[model samples]
Target: MMTNLQKASLFFLSFLMISIMACSRELSHDDNEEEIIFKEESSTGEPEHYQAVPNDLVLIYDGGAHRRIQWGKEHFAPYVSAEVNGEEKWLFDGFLFLEIHDGRGRGFASGYQAMAARKTEWENLLENYFAKGNGIHALNEQIEEMRKTGRVTGEFEKRKVVLCIPEPIPNQTDWGQLDGRSLQFFRKEDRIDACKWYIDFAEQLFQDANFEHVELVGFYWLAEEATNSRNLAKDVADYVYGKKYDFYWIPYFNSDGYSEWRNLGFNVPYYQPNYFFSESIPYSRLQEACDRARKFQMNMEIEFDDRALKNNGWGYRLTDYLDVYEKNGVFDSLKVAYYQGGDAFYKLSQSEEEADRALYRRIIHLITQRAEEGVD
Candidate 1:
């Protein structure tokens, strides 16, 4: 009995209602199951989707020891992303250095004595820093919270944290000279005992439950005088093997006898030159060491002094070393070392506020660059 136009309109309305219902059903079905979000295909012209990934590498700087959390937030977190050929690629795998010094106020002469006296204070400091809801602990909690809220843009589920601890050099005479005669009076056994005490203390502090998610990386400073290659190597191996520690780094300045350390079985996974412009062990020598360590399947890390590249001597420039290393294919998975301390030349004369900004900018740049490039 309906007119032809009314019949046509009714039919169209029915079809549209059915289509909407079907679409709603499909969407409900999808919502019930686990969603697989894939990165947008390049051809799709959609924005690439980022997911939480585990952090595999941690690059700790020296700031954490002073109870400063601003560094991680303002400098480290924002710029760390991987890239390929100038395009954004992936996020960083691990954590960075957090400089903790045992012999903070102690002069060389009474270094051991001072550490002994300050042992209780050191433990207290560590407890507060790693305490729940504080310091690195708080930073980590915030990140985890972000993940839970689905706000984290990169892979956070698989990230692991690493703690970088720069060990004190026994003979940092430049700060305050240690008395040789006093040191000589102690027997070798006594000296070893003192060293062991400090190492044990450090290990205890690092292994505490408060540092639950952190892995330790020991940075052994090569002293030109007191710490010979053999001793350093032996100490490092003794300290790290079978411990909760993750890796070892041998900074290359004053490493005149590092070959001895290598020969003695101190297989360091990462090596950075302590100072720019210092002569590195020859390429052949380094290759030999790397090859030898390969029996144990060790990874080597090289760090370029970016500050040196900007200012220092021409020979210390990154361009010079990069060309050589790249030509030799030695930099396949290397990392560049950029310091953000007051030591950098540009920050030397700047006001405290300006210097701090410059320092952080340099750090952020280095971290972001490494993240983009997957630099080791």
Candidate 2:
């Protein structure tokens, strides 16, 4: 009852529809596999996509002078990889080394110690940070492990490192004592000079250390807020930029100068949520924090510590952060900084308790997820 021509036309139409459907499926898969790019704040304070942005910036603090906090191979082991689906996958890709208080009298801020970091103190800090004479340069060891295990290749093989600049706490006696220049912090010029000295000193140390695996990408401002030191901040930033290095800041939630980070001359400014430590601040704080990060076109800091292992409400706080961040798409959309309180993540990784281990796995999964999603 059917004509031969009509039957042939129907067959061709069906074949065409099937081909289109198959091509659509392939396109959808490709979209999912595309690299995750990030938006950076341009000179005009607008969001612009930058392909070279660092994906995850991890803070490695509490390892400076006079402290026994040796970040040796064991401490860095868990940070690099974990057995996921029977394969070792790499974790965070960046490290920011800093300290608030050296066992001696120097501190990064005025509240921590009366004395600012002197030349000798900074020398010790650099030695410890680079693991100079400690028989194990942490960064180098990490690279070796990755290479031996065949985990990192191509550009991902090299890690990024950011060093901290101790705040030039005003009125410190050492300012006048450093390098016999008789610098006085009371004068605006003296404060800027001290910061320049620190930057130059750090550069010298980095060169002397001859670290092969890590790239010195930028420098961080130790002060959480810059209300009183606007002139000092801008001047220090300009000096760092002149030396072909980027300047960074991470102001506390709603702290002074948070909104004016770009004007203050910071290349990267991450907004601190400050949610993990405090018990009073409700979980709702994370929503606001995520909103602020997106609204200001800023990166974010993830805060946690050893207390995450405790069997109390504190543990839940970390879970809250993961949930809130995922819901707000921070895990995928924004660059991140992890502020684990002095090796807490390492403790979690080595924890004997199953709950703690589970928590550690969750955090690693999120971190590795970001890395796999194409972090630069």
Candidate 3:
């Protein structure tokens, strides 16, 4: 008995109800108090459509870190060098010098000692990177030596340095403020304050050291995972940006907040496959990591240890990283971070074994090729 218009309206209303129900799916968050609502297409619950907010939340001198960030494809460009008169530029490639935490547990035992230890460590690293007769300098020489014999042609610059920010352990009491009040890292604000102090202190060291062969382009977050310190990460990032320097992070695979690195305010986040150190992890993880990095618009990290320096059974692991990354086109397409376990690369460069030397040269070749590509 209904008219045609009424019938059409009823059908449209039914379809609208079904569509609204379809879009009502919710995403789970670790913090139960807040939730992110977005439209997703698949069962995997990845965002199909969402809003991205530009990171305009500036840190005031009064002090602060995380705010909303908009994700975009443009954020994932190859590492851009900050060049000035052919010297002192940014990083596309970097060597992670892990002097902040000496594995022997003999140094960096406390925030106060860390401060003193890092001063000496910076001197050694600068010397290694620039001073003649060091391993990194020798590697640079080899890069040029190979370049002269190859078809690849381009200019090379000093290696850009990224230093680590020591974590403010909660019990450390020596970290005092401008007001002479000692900071207790038990509170989040105190930890952030300590980080800001470290940045300021490191900047002073860099200015004083005045190394000409390399650039102090940025600082790295020492924590491998973000964990519950999202605000801490963001505040440090904002503070670093305020200083006009880049903030870098290399989150282990599937670590918390790794996918939302941009949102959390890290300028350059690299995905660590974590495959090199563990024998249980398969090579497939390297490709999987590449896929995840591409998905999240992040860079990649190449990990190797002392095992690669000799006839150790684990030497093949380094080769696996090289092969997988090469197959995935990571060398040509993305910025890379080198994680040579505590002086391993330097040892390799100084090795008397031909096999070890060959491995070192191969790495240099790939690095030169990357520089030639003008990956910006």
Q: Whose lDDT is greatest here?
A: 2
**What is the TM-score of each predicted model, taking all chains together?**
0.48, 0.82, 0.62
- What's the candidate order when arranged by decreasing TM-score? 2, 3, 1
Candidate 2, which ten residues in sequence have the lowest lDDT sum? 22-31
Candidate 2, residues 1-376, lDDT tens digits: the string is 3332343355446544533433221121122332322343233544332224567777888544565556777678777667665667777777888888787766666556645666567666666776643322675676676768776433455577788887777665564455667777668888887778778878887788777776777889988777446778989888877777778789887667788888887878899887776565556566667767776777888899878886643677888788777766677767788888887888888888888888888888787778777633
Q: Which of candidates 1 and 3 is the stronger one according to lDDT?
A: 3
Candidate 3 off by > 4 Å: 1-93, 100-158, 171-178
TM-score, cand. 3 vs. native: 0.62
Give the lDDT ranking, best first: 2, 3, 1
* Candidate with the larger TM-score of 1 and 3: 3
lDDT values for all models: 0.37, 0.70, 0.54
Put down candidate 1 lDDT per residue, 1-376, tens digits, no spaces.
4432343365446544533433221121222443211111122321121222122233443332343434333233332332334444334444444443333542112222232213333344445445655545654554444445554343333334444323333332122112332332124433444344445665566566444323444433323222333454455445554453433343333234433444443443344332223332233323333333233223333333324322433223333333333443333343333333322322322325543444334433444444444432
Model 3, C-alpha of 157: deviation from truth (Å): 3.0
